[model samples]
Target: MGETSLRRLPLVIMLLAAGCARQAPSPAPPRVETAAAQLPEQSSAIVVPVTADLRMLERGLDANTPRVLWTVDEHRDTCVRGKRVDLGIGKVKLTPDLGCRIVGQVTRGAIRVAGAGERIDITMPVSAKIAVRDIGGVLGETATARAIVHATGRLGVTGDWQPRATLDIAYDWREPPGIDIAGQRITFTSRADEKLKRVVRRLERDLPKEVAKLDLRRQLGDVWQRAFTVIELSKRNPPAWMRVTPRALGFGGYRIEGRQLRLTLAAEALTQTFVGRRPADPTPTPLPPPSRVAGQPGLRFFIPVLADYAQLEPVVLRTLRKLAAGGITLTGIGPVDVDFGKVTVYATTGNRLAVGVTARVVPRDRDFPATSGEAWLTAQPYNDEGSQLVQARDVKLAADTDSTAVDLIVSLLDATQVQRAVALALRHDFAPDYRKVLGKAQHAIGARQEGDFFLSTDVTRVTTGQLQVTGAGLFLPVRAEGSARIDYRPR
Candidate 1:
């Protein structure tokens, strides 16, 4: 071969070698981070008021008691001593000399029921009239009497949430009726008293039947089911929800006010908060037998301040892209240029966050070739006390394939610039969200009606909790403590 041709062959070999180096295959993408975690459950209360209208008992009394309670009819003769005549028998037998006929009737007027502490008082007015027929031209007379039937009723709730009343009934005479003839006074109180005994028995038997009309069990059941709900704290930005699951039932006792009896029912529940899409409401369970509950029942729940991993991706990508725009310098390698591909953020084990970055890196150094692959980094995010700024510490770096090319890129990731950028992306201000959440929640808990029950709530205080990293996102638990009450107002 000629010398000039051999020289040209060397240049061609050099050009072919450069093309082969640039055509090397790119490394595979890194695997995403995985973690299993759940937010802590909190305790809360759902209070229900079961009310019974006592006017029903009044109507029942009016319907059950007859207007004409009883009637009395009797005829008797009393012998009168004739003037002392000559030859009159010394001890003449008491013979009928005066004829008397008495007829009487007892009738009820109106019934009224009123509340007295935990018990109720039922009162009814009664009137009686007696006519003594004129006999032997003896002046005829009519006697009238007034009386009142009084009953003391005690209210109670059964284990299964049934309302019942027990009545202690009796009657008192305001005016006694009687007749007077020849200094002989005839009283009808004994006969009236006997009739009252029967009336009292009937009232005692009928009170509970009237109380059943209150429908207390149905009211309580509606409250129990309504308590199992998911209350939305915020609609967007960071959609937050609080789930309530009733666990047990408690009896806070009963009170009589005006003409109604109110039974306080407290439901002990487990509350949990979530961020993102709304959570499903808990399935309602049957009303359980009430147990004694201590202290005043109040509402307690958590409102989570969350940062979804998907939301963090864009923020992190923007930071990385801006930093990579000017190119970054490594410790061992002098100056290297980087172009970001995709950024992924998610929770990892030990309450840490995992960030995966895909990039195509070019090195200015002669020994290192241009490389393209994904780099994985893990960090523990934390927020200082009374501060909203979140920063990361103990950042670790890894890759799918370990080599000098990947190590150079990892060194660039170790720079404070990248670390600070990630930390800045994690910086979440909870003040605005906190205030908005509280305001919305307060509005949500306002007095509202569900079925036949009226619900009301008052939030007194809120306490902040520690930060948690779950599979879904970064969650900060904010516990709200308050009081809640539900009244039975049937429509």
Candidate 2:
């Protein structure tokens, strides 16, 4: 071998070494990290349905009916111009005096809600009696009589009643009918003698004072007012956990089908639920404008849940540190350092969530050294019934890594194992404490007592929807549906 050839062999070896070093890609450039977006303050809504049947009102009317409706007492004076009477066997000039009194009562039949133009129609069966006493006149004539009189046999009355009803508003009855006696009949009792009967019929045209005693307005008002009072709903022995405030009441007219009159009642109000304690008395404030009913009649309410990423930082960091302390073994690199850094969360399309994390990977062998990397994970959130919280599920790594260092780390590490570990850690700390917050909210919304009324909420169903990224952490909307009833407990 020549000396020049040996020198050329050394240069060739140097060139080969340079080529080998160039095969590995260059480390990624440092990123100028920006501050993460902050959570916003916002609100969500839920719509509830309300329904009222007119039949329930009828019960109140029946209970409030008075046994005696009316009574009457009347007096009159008469001057006999010329009259001659024979008492026993003597003849005498006589001037007679007269007085009368009558009493009557209204026996009401079934009061029904009439259709469309008519608010309520009722048939009243009336019975009355008459009494007459004639004081002594110039001829010394004194007599007393007791007899039964037939007045209005069956009186049919139709009342046009309008009620005020709206969402989150006050309620009242409008355009109620006045008590009418236009169709009333005036009748006199028949006596055994024709002359005496004729004398009794002379006062038939006079209106019975008992008709004035019937107070239909006051009676009807009591029925409606009692029905529209506060509604109470609760389980036996548990007292009441919730209350509903009915703000307004309105009638949807009525329809007569066969013998039944079906009436519709519209009641608008807000519902509240209590968790730990119950309120002694809670007055109902005017309701806000009600949301339109979508499908059926049922109570509805909205609940907001916030999920903050900051709350999860400590849990995630702890899990990552635990994994790092154990030193994960790689396929070819043996045991390696898996150190995790900061994490940021963001909202994405389709009501989903994304988390970005910074991490470092160091191979056990000093020759490989360590590299910083960034990773992104996408997740879908849902309501976890068992935990009573909204939890992150189906966590997957997003594929848009611009960092070359992160790309190198991906190639050297077991991607599946890392993803699995991260997902498990997220599952542990990715949700808020729903049980605590919701429990407090429920307790705060407890039962209230209005004037002569008790309002309580009866929660039947609770549902949860997907997560929404808003300025206010992770926003989750919850819906609760139930019914509101007003019960009358007189003070």
Candidate 3:
């Protein structure tokens, strides 16, 4: 309490020597979650203790046998002594002989015991903003530490505390990077002793329980183990669920002019989050056009087409997300073309279905006779629709014996082919409703060409089992029925 008593306290002196003693290794590091990475709600905790050696202090000072130095040695005789701070533990009695020097103004509030050769000084308020790197054992040599502790400055205790009454204890020891004592306080309460015993007893029982719970946590803590396995595998290799196949059922020369490419996308095996209600897209409405581009040369045509750009899902099915979501987007393109006297365009996609179509084309000069009948254009002799197509009459030459008598037969044939094929094209554009579980209905289109000396004959037959191409992209329905009108100069 008074300056005289502080100086009277027995000092525990220590000196460290590199050749003899060494510092103990610090605790191991643990896993950490950065701000960028997501962390779970719970974390693990730890437990440890605090201890000190009165025996080692006595050996360092050789209290029983005083060392004989050079007779004139003034250093050890004039010991670096000062009024040291005493650490009292409850009713623990601090003997008045622990003489320690009060070192450089308790900067960090921790105590230090330093030894240089035979010179020993019990440094009080041992902590500092910068750490004292070199600290050997009490033997004053670099050797292993006889003891280690997990004490904190915030607990009003950081050094090796000697318990005159209460045993030095470390409870609920969590790895603290900084002095984060959530709520630790020391009160000279009358019942504090009773409270400490109760808390210690309860914690002794509850800590083992908490520790037991964490052991279970180490088991059930990671749910991503199985999920991430599939994800990582998919990153290195393709997933088994996704399969994409592309195909086209072309209508050959029956297309209005040059063949048009119509793309159809079919996806399957998708997560429920991305799937939504089926939207029935508007079919392309037909608009009439000129029989031929006046003063236009060569059998070339312009074809304008469109496909479903309206995405049904929230996120787009890119290569990455598709693999992540474990879904497939089957994409394919097909084409159908018919020759007019000039460039022509037929078949295009709207919001969902490729609906409208038109083509500008110029037929071959009428040196050859033109085929008659819708069946003739769709027939094997010129029906390129079949795999083994027989191009018997891909084109014919112009026979302008006169404007009226000259061959308009080729034009008639081209017109018939364009009509039937286009009807089929529109039918193909519609997509099946994805909402229902069942597949789409069937469809088909047939055409027959009839001819008379008076005018050319073009007949059409449309048939369909059922169709679901309501919201899908443009296509030539393999099975569908519909008819289209094509005239020879407005016959």
lDDT, candidates in the order shown? 0.72, 0.42, 0.20
Query: How do the predictions measure up, each by TM-score?
Result: 0.65, 0.45, 0.16
For model 2, where is the 10-residue window of minimal lDDT? Answer: 164-173
Output the number of the lDDT-best candidate. Answer: 1
Per-residue lDDT for 1-491 in model 2, tens only?
A: 67855654653354334334444433332222221222222111212111223343344443444333333344434322235599988968774333333333222344232223223332222233333333222222222222222222111122423222111111111211111112322233221223223322421222111111122234324433443332223231112243444554443343444334333334544445332234344453433222232234555654445555565566666766787787676654457777777766656655556666677777675434465666566666665542345566776655544432224345332355665665665553223444444454455444554454444545566666545554335655455555444433335
lDDT of 3 by residue, 1-491 (tens): 66744442321011112112323211111212211111111111100011112233323323322222101101121112223455664343332222111111111122223333222223221111111111121111111111111121101111121111112323221221111111221111222224334433432333223223222122211211211111110111111111111111111111111111111111111111001222222222222111111221111110111122242111111212223243222111012122222211211122112211112212232222222211112111112241111112222111222232222222332343333333332221222321111111111011222121011111122222221122232111122111222121101
**Candidate 1 vs candidate 2, TM-score winner:** 1
Residue-level lDDT tens digits of model 1 in 1-491: 77855654653344335434444333323333433224578776666666657666688777887889889887767423333334465754444466667787889888888866777887888888988775545756788988888888787878877767777888888997776656656678898888888877887777777777666678668777887898887786457778889888887777788877777777788888776777888999988887855444677877666666887789889988888886788665568888888887877667888887877767675445566656677778887764545667777664443442334445556677787777777666667767777888888776788887778888888876677777767766678888876666658
Better of 2 and 3 by TM-score: 2
Best-first order by lDDT:
1, 2, 3
What TM-score would you give candidate 3 relative to the actual structure? 0.16
Instruction: Report the number of the highest-TM-score candidate.
Output: 1
Give the least accurate 10-residue stretch of model 3, judged by summed lDDT: 42-51
Q: What does the lDDT read for residue 278 in candidate 3?
A: 20
Model 2, TM vs. native: 0.45
Comparing 1 with 3 on TM-score, the higher-scoring candidate is 1
